[model samples]
Target: MSSAYKTSAVENTSKYGPFTKMVDVYGLKILGLGNVGGQPQVSTEFLNKTAETFKLLLDPNAAGINKKSREKALKGLTSYNVIQRVGVKAHITHTRQALIAAKYRAGTKSMTSIDQEQTSSGICDLMGGPTLLLEQAQITENLEHALHTITQFALPAAFPQEMNISSKNGKASGISGDLYKALREAIANGVYDDSDYSRQR
Candidate 1:
């Protein structure tokens, strides 16, 4: 972990229960786990946290309000039609440390040394269309990329070997190193598409 990962767990009032939020040195929040009664809070908070995390992923230097990523993440979050798509079924468990894994992905993916960092946390399988579907024609695709990035790259970095999500049937498998580079490059070049916002148009 290289002391890069920091955990902040708070005991909430009886109404909310306790929750654990994990962040890295960049102030990028990586995970949010519900504790005790907090499990119910996860569904509501997950989307916003996930949005913030995506913004941090794209622009680590971003701070304050990030309305763009938030809005886009919202649309994307609703458009993950995974079963409809013919994506492959595979599983991968990250045994590497969080920081190390992040660095590896960032490095091999050719990320620039962040001048600074700021941050937030669903996560799921990857499902993007041509030209990334992120820097493309819709918010749905953008979300697909965002979720993919989180599920494949970010979650593994956060949870490491325990990245699997249990399902009613069993456990489903989980990305690679190259697509991440593409995401960084596209977003850096201001290629995120916002043509059709889900349920807003």
Candidate 2:
């Protein structure tokens, strides 16, 4: 049996928080080993069984999942395919935004024209000024663009509930908050798909 399957079986047996932590540690070790070119030998049956166990753990309703069910409701979040998808989405979004910013900077003669073009192209709406800084960094060799890019990627993935906080309190926060909110909404609304990233190529 796969280590993942064994771990999942153990996880189902205990309600203790430390057990969960141990499972997480083991899972990470397994993932690390896989990354280091020593992938564990696991059967397809084992993997499928482990996935089913995970699905059961994630579902609030312990009732069996029907094969014909179109949508399965999950109680707890699972890392499953979400992390990979998010990573791809972020990469594609950043690269596309940077290319657009570079193209805009190259073609525009003035700051006003740059702003007009950015607004028209919706780059500003997607990434704010960080992408523009990335393009400027290419010409000026500035390290701040690297820092801005890091900050841009670190923004929260969920929408902010306090929309009026900025206007009501007169406190300025990071510029990426609105961008994160928009991105979250877009994801929830299915505005972008997995195949959307392929179009960038």
Top lDDT model: 1
TM-score of candidate 1 versus the correct structure, residues matched by position: 0.21
Off by over 4 Å in 2: 1-36, 59-201
The 10 consecutive residues of candidate 2 with the worst lDDT sum are: 110-119
lDDT of each: 0.32, 0.25
Error of 2 at 67 (Å): 17
TM of each candidate vs. truth: 0.21, 0.18
User: For residues 14-121, what per-residue lDDT tens digits would candidate 2 score against the true structure?
Assistant: 222111111221121111001111222222332333334334433324577342221221100121211100001123334334434433211111110110001012
Whole-structure CA lDDT of model 1: 0.32
lDDT of 2 at 92: 35
In model 1, pairs of residues that clash are 29-120, 49-121, 50-121
Worst 10 residues of 1 by lDDT: 83-92
Q: Indicate the residue-level lDDT of 201 in model 1.
A: 24
